[model samples]
Target chain A: MLEIKNLHVKLEEEDKVILKGVNLTVETGKVHAIMGPNGSGKSTLSYVLSGRDGYEVTDGSALLEGEELLEMEPEERAAAGLFLAFQYPVEIPGVGNMTFLRTALNAQRKARGQDELSAGEFLKVVREKAKTLKIDADMLKRPVNVGFSGGEKKRNEILQMAMLEPKMCILDETDSGLDVDAMRLVADGVNALRDAGRSFLVITHYQRLLDHIKPDVVHIMADGRIIQTGGPELALEVEQNGYADILKAHGLTEAV
Target chain B: MGAAVQKSTLEARLEGLSTTGFAPAARKDALARLVAMGLPGRRDEYWRWTNPADFIAATPVPAQAFDDSDEAPVFEATDRVKLVFVDGVFDADASDDLALAGVEITRLAEAPDLNWASGLYGTLEVAGQTPVARPLAALNTAAATDGLLIRATAKAEKPINLIYIHRSEVSDPILHHVIRLEEGAELTILENGPAGARFNKVMEVDVAKGARFHHVRVQGRDHERRAATAIFARVAEEALFKSFTLTVNGVLTRNECVIDMVGDDAVAHVAGAALGDGASDAFLHDDTVFVTHGAERGESRQVFKKVLKHGAVGTFQGKILVKPGAQKTDGYQISQSLLLDDDSQFLAKPELEIYADDVKCSHGSTTGAIDETALFYLRSRGVPMEEARGLLVLSFLADAIDEIEDEGLRDDIVGRLEAWLNRHRD
Candidate 1:
């Protein structure tokens, strides 16, 4: 469902390559977790996939559903069923959350030749989904992400992913700043949306979130590239022994 | 003198006081004081943004009798007590007497020279007298036409509404209205501008100790009309003064408001929203001074928001002043504007002058286009671009309009604002 081939990205100003010759592939009906330390280009990969501005894809292409995703604009990528749950969602004042969500959902629907939902029907669906996620009604009426707690904002991102129901979902540090309860709630929301013919690329620094949403494949990333990939047991190994073992196995560790 | 000089003098006598009821000696004294101050010009600091001299150069035509045969007001709140004035004369048939116990609604000409009017007239200065206002205000004082003077006595409970309506097509007609609220009095006034006429009007408000004065000025006029109105308010000890000025239409309109917090613990809230299109020019200037002399705490806030499109021009200037001994003073002024089209322009200046070391004063001014993310968010929801823009613009102005305590008046102004947006959306 999603493929990244030698995805090389560089900062616009310094031209310093961040993602160097990184490759990854995920089939439909599967979940892949990308575990990386800070500055490992995990967030860059998500941004490149979603077509955010300012990241120069120096060399490489990202394909979603066999379509060239890198060539599409942000909205177009969104319409084409590619979703990136931002690490830090932008706060938009004077724009209600419900209004934004409905617009995005209807926009994707319209792009796919589907009828738009009326306000009443849209409200009904949103309210039911919100109830399941434990999102209060007042939160929906507030400005998008304005004055929301960190966990609440992350939950809102998950809510958008649920509403859009994209074919491919990329979660970037979705567990950061979340309490134990919030982390469980976020994991539960993602789990409920899981199904065959849908894919997820969960990016994180720790293996805690991996416990809730089990992944079929776990990849250890360091120095802007994926150094190793193994079965789900790799995550438990990294949690217990840290990345030292992986770095030593790759023969990249400096001499003491 | 000579025969020709005698003829000229006879002609001057024939003119018989350009207007009526003006005491020559008093008018002369006021005119002398005005002449000394001189007409406010572009060089004047307060009049820097606005070229009062240039505006007065055109010399708007003098006040003339208006034809009252036109249709009634395009919109009027049914619950509001209405007062209509044609030209500079109050229309008795268009006004209803308020038999409310604590309220006194009468014409300025009918009342005795009260101490408040004597003290307020020509005493408030906004960046020195501009050439335009110097001559115009001097002329207004010289002519001294009839004006509405509404008073709410001390401890008055009910809110008194004073509707100053301008019904005319005259060019340079000037109208003056004064309001006084005694200690512990409460008053709410709704002042409406001319529908399709040119005017230069001034209103002076004196709020006494512990009084509460709420004013909402609604300006929804034709685009061809030109107007410049000023509202000067003096708030006494522990007094509360709140004003919301809404401008939806006009060719060239400016509403200048100055609130002087003379006593401590006085609070003032001055908010304005100007939405214009099609060569319309709307400017709102709020100059507030919070003086915390005896009372330790005083608060003043000013917020002005404007939406401009289709070559429209919007300006917001807010200044807050805190005196030397006025410690613990809280003053905040924010001016924001949104320009919808390339041709539209906005100018905002938020000024803060504080002498007291312990005072908290801040001012902010920002001009920008609508939030693209918000816009796309709305459009993606199937709302057309224009509708989305209108909704955002309305939301932007909602902050200022929400300051209005009167729900009906707020709705009326909002409705007119929406209509203006709908008519001007391209």
Candidate 2:
């Protein structure tokens, strides 16, 4: 469902290159886990795919369901079923959480030429989804993540993923600030959406998240490129021996 | 700076204007003060940020009335005692019956007996004249043609809403109002509409011991209109006074609020939200506020927010003064502006003076643009760029809008703000 062909990216304001000749592809209905050390350009790939600013694509292209995502605006990418779960959710002080979600849903619907959902209808559906994710009614009524805790924010992201029902989801360090219980709750939410029609790109440093939302394929990314590809066992190898051994086997000498 | 030239300046401005004598003593005193102070100019320290030329011009500059037919009249369906004014004249036929329980309403145009209003009409205006002068308010008191004199003796069942309508292209209207609440009485006043081509208004409120007074106003009319308005209020012991104004799309607007907390444990809050867009050099908004704490344990808060674009200019001058004996006073002031582009500008001056050492007071001012990270987050959620920016702008004004006591009135104001943002979306 998602494909990347030799995506080369660099910081727009700086001369440093981040993703140097990176290529990857995730088939339909599959979960791909990318394991990398710090500053290995894993997050840059997700940002470039989601059409975030501050990054210039020097060469190559990213396609989502055969549509070029690099040429589309962020909202258009979202309407075309590309979702990026941010590492840091924004805090909007005055916009209510429910209103923000409803606006997003209706906007995507309008962009897709679908009828908008009424307030009442939207409320019923949101309440049901929020219940399974353990988000309380007060959290939904408050301003969008203004005073939410880490766990609540991550869960809120999962709730958006579920509501949007995107074709391909990219989890960019979603487990960074979450506790173990929060991680389990978030993984359960992601696991619930696993099916034959949706694909996910799980980016992480540890294999703990993969143990919950088991991936079908695992790839080791080093120096802005995938140097090793294997099954789920590869995640265990990286967790057990660290990237030092992987880098050594790949004829590279870099400590992580 | 000769006395004769000052007199001529005042005379030229007040030419061809006559009104029914409401409070002869107060009006005479106000005229004397206006003559002494003359009119504000760009050289004045208080008027440096915003020139008073439009307000001081001899003849009202003509303005083509803004077409607001697409918007529903604010507070039209609310349950309240409605009073309508056209070009500063009271429209008895267009207004509801001037009778309500627990309150007394007197029209200034009828030359009615001032009764309790005789001493309280311009008392606050005169008292607030020290240290700084507000000559425009003095002019309004001296030349205003008509307004309402309302006194609430008990808790009122409904709000008192005054709606102003503009129909003349060259109407120059000056209106002065007096509001008094007796001990333990409660009242809320709502004012909206574009009054005239050039509008000058002043409201003086007397909140008695333990009384509560709330005022919410919307200064909107034709986009080309120019207005200068002032509110002078005195809060007694244990009394509460709150006033908020929302300004949208005027060539020039200056709203000044002066409040005095005279008794212990009194609370006062003055806040405003202004949105301006200037295609030329016509849009400028200024808010000048002064709050004084004179008693023990008094509390005062001033919150003002502005959103400017298209080279529109906004200015804020606010001060909080705590007297020598006003120990345990708590005062807070904040002024913030969101400039949508490089062309827009915001100027703010926040001051705090504490004669008492045992008081807590803080003031802050900020000018910034939209948060780009937040913008990207919203866009990633599939919200269009314009709608996302509009949402953020409304959020920036939430602090000022929250000062309103009524939820319905708050919703009405939000609806109008949203409409303004949608129309100005670029």
Candidate 3:
């Protein structure tokens, strides 16, 4: 569902390389987990794939299905079914959450040459999707992410993912600020969206999130490269023993 | 001295004026005040940021009337008493029947000698001139040819819509409006359109004890049109006064608002939202506001915001004053601007003066570009760049837009802003 080859990235404003010679692929309907310590280019990879600014791709290419994702604008990439759940959801004052979601859904549909949903149709669907995430009517009516608790914000992100139904989804530390109950709720939401046509790339610092939405494969990333690729047991192994064993075994301790 | 000052600046500007509105005594007094104050000049402290050369010149710059009819007229869907004016001339044929007015309304040109408005006209303008001078408002009071004189003794059933339509390329129009609300009365005034190539307008409102007044105005349509507008309002005991203005597309514009809370517990709020793009015509918009709290427990708020791009310029000067005996006064003022590009400029001056130490007053001004993180967040959610920027701009202007007390009017203003954004897409 997603492919990357030797993806090298650097800061656009300075001479700082973030992602160096990184490559990964996620097959259709599968969940892949990328675990790493701080400053290990995991979040940077997610940002680069989402077409965020301030990062220059020195070399390499990322493709969604067969289309080159790097050449497209962020919105175009989104229309092509790539979604990134941010670590910190932006707080946009004066823009209602419902308005933002409706606009995004209709915009994506319009870009794909599909019919736009009517207001009534949109309201009904949004209400249904928001219910499972435990988001009430007031939260939907309020401004996007403004005054929202950590649990509410994470749930809102899952609601968005459900509504857009992207082909490839990237969860960037979605569990960092969430409590245990909130994390389980978020995992349940993601687990519900697990279908044969969707792929997940879970980026995290702990294996707690994986315990809920179980990954098919886990890759240990360090020093801008993926040095270890294994199954779900690998995440437990890293959680039990820190990235030190993996870094030293790969002779990346000095780089760390 | 008055004659000498008038001849120096307004020699040719007032060559063909023979407009007599209200009583002779009031008109004569306004003329005398205007002549004494004289036309504003570049050296004047109030006109330092805006060049009054074009306004002082003998002839106005010519502009072709814009003929776009793609969008519906503002407030067209709402029910209102329509009063149409073409280049300062009241169009009797286009206006509705006077018998159908929801409130007591009279034309300034046809008002009787002992008219109710004659006693109130220019009263607030004169009172607003203590700390700073507004010579243009005095000029409108003295020289306006025609306007509407509105008085609401009870809650008005419908709003009064003042529709100014521009047709002449070189038309320079001056208009004066006077409004009065008796005790416990209520009224809402809606004004819109580009009056002419050059326009000068003044509105004076006296909100009596327990009365309420709401005002919403939209300025622009002609890119080359230039305008100078001023609103002076006086709020009495427990009265409520709220006003909001939306400005777009004009080349040079200045809006001055002065509000005085004269009686205890009175409340007043004045806000403005402006959008300027200099890709075609130069854009300059200045909002200068002063709010004074003179009675105990009075509250006043001044909120102004502007979005400028492509070398456009925005300026804001806002002040709040709490008089000595005005204890427990609550005053809040904020002026902000979003410059979309390096060439755009935002200038702000915010002031607070409180004689009563117990009063609560705060004033702040800010200027910056769009929040990049927020912009990216929107785009990442599938909104296109232009659409995302428009959303952020609307959000930035939302606070000021909310000052409009009516829901339908607020939606109409939002529609107008959205249309402007679409037309000026990056």
Candidate 4:
């Protein structure tokens, strides 16, 4: 359902290239895990796909169900069924979380020519989703992410993803800064949303989150390029043996 | 109606004042001081943001005669005891003399004696020191005919509301009110400007030790009327004073507030919201002085918010002063404005003066259009642009309106604000 062909991205000010000919494709009903060390351009890929400003797409293209996703605005991309669970959610003071979420949801609905939901109906749906996600109703009343703890912010991100219900979801370092319990809870939330005709790309540094979601395909990336692709057992192999041995075996340690 | 005419006519009228009062000596001295000051011009430091002389010069109408019409108040169903004043004169028939446990409500002219009147009159006069030497104040003192005086004795448990309603027709009317809350006493005063009338009014409040005073003023005059009012408050040791002014209408409106935190451990919060539109020019100037005379732990805060649309102009100027040896003083002032239309304009200046080293003081001012993200967010939620703008503006002014302690008064002001928004919404 989602495809990225030789996607290349570079910073505008400098000659530094962040993504180098990265290629990935995920069909319906499958979860793809992209495991990478630091500086492997995982988060950058998420930003570019989500249409965040200031990221220049030098070459290649990204498509969601055969529709061009790169040309849309950040909000438009969100409406086009592309969701990026941000690593760091922006804190908007004086804007309540429910107010923000309702705005986003209704904006997408209105763009698609759908009838808007009443406040009562919207609150009902939100409360049900929030209960399953272990989010308190009071948190929805507060200003978005202001004074929220690290784990709470991440949970908020998942809650937003569930509310938006995009066709393709990209989770960037969702496991970072989460305890073992929070990690399992978040994994469970993601697993529940996974279904036929919907796809997910879970990006993480550790194999702990992978144990719960159980991806079908695993890819290891280094130096802005994907170098290895294997089954789920490949994750445990890399967990026991670090990336150095894998790079040495692939002859990519000295290729650069 | 224009700036030039407003300025010239006000000048001519001030030049023609024939001063007469019970305190003729003080009135004459104040008039001479006003003449020397000669209606603050743009060149003056304090009047830079809003020039009353210029506004008065254009629409120079004579002092209005008393209108005894039984015009009902816009805010009905108020629970607090009411004292209404019509056309600068006290309305005895429209008010109730409630024998509350610990309050006193009486007219200034009918006080049997002039003891309190003599002491409270001219208390807020600048005495030729500052540029805001009270030209309109002098006009009120010389021509006020009558006013209301509500006093709360020391440690009074109950609070009273003094309501002033202006009713005028062909001329501009003025009213002067003085409220004194003695030591440990508490009172809440609600003042509403008359609709469809030109009003120039002044009110002075003196708060004593450990006393608490709450004042809420709502100006909802018709767009054709012009209104100018000044509020002066003096706070004593361990006393708490709060004042809120909401201006939602009038062709030309200027509501100025001066708060003096004179005693140690005295706290004061002064806030206002000015919503203007349709060729209206609403100016709000807040001059607060935190005098820390050996009274440590004095605190003061002021916030002013203005929302302008349809070529309206809103101006806010706030100043906080910390005197020498007034250590441990905390003072903060912020003024923000939201302009809805390209033709609308907002000017803000926040000033802080500190003579002591151990004082914490900061002042900030910002003027801009509504947040585009917030606007788009609301519009995307099926709310029309005008309604969305109104909601945002309401939230913007909520910071100031929320300071009012009385729920009735707060809701009254909010209702007036909504009415103003509905009138100006496109």
Best by DockQ: 2
> Candidate 2, residues B370-417: lDDT per residue as tens digits?
999899899998998999999999889988999998888889889889
Q: Give per-residue CA lDDT, model 1, range A1-256, as digits (tens).
A: 9988998899887868889988999989899999976777888888778775567988888889889988876777877888888777767765678977886788678878899999999999899888878899999999888899998998998888888888899998999999999999999999999999799999998889999999999998877789999989999998998887787777766323
Worst 10 residues of 1 chain A by lDDT: A247-256
Cα error, residue B131 of model 4, in Å, equals 8.3
Residue B48 displacement (Å), model 1: 2.0
Candidate 2 residue-wise lDDT, A1-256, digit = tens: 9989998999999999989888899999999999898888898888889888999999998888898999999999999998999889999998889999999999999999999999999999999999999999999999899899998998999999998899899998889888899999999999999989999999998899998889999989988889899999999988888899888887877744
Query: What TM-score would you give candidate 4 relative to the actual structure?
Result: 0.75
The candidate with the higher DockQ, 2 or 3, is: 2
Instruction: Spell out the clash pairs found in candidate 4.
Output: B5-B57, B5-B58, B6-B57, B6-B58, B7-B57, B7-B58, B8-B57, B9-B57, B10-B57
What does candidate 1's lDDT look like per residue over B173-245, in tens digits?
Answer: 5666778889898888777656224566767788889999998876664444466677777888899989988
- Cα deviation of B276 in candidate 1 (Å)? 6.3
In model 1, the Cα lDDT at residue B360 comes to: 80
Predicted structure with the largest lDDT when compared to the true one:
2
Models 1 onward score TM values of 0.76, 0.97, 0.97, 0.75
lDDT score of model 4? 0.71
Best to worst by DockQ, what's the order?
Answer: 2, 3, 1, 4
Task: State residue A139's C-alpha deviation in candidate 2, in Å.
Answer: 0.3
Rank the models by TM-score, top first: 2, 3, 1, 4
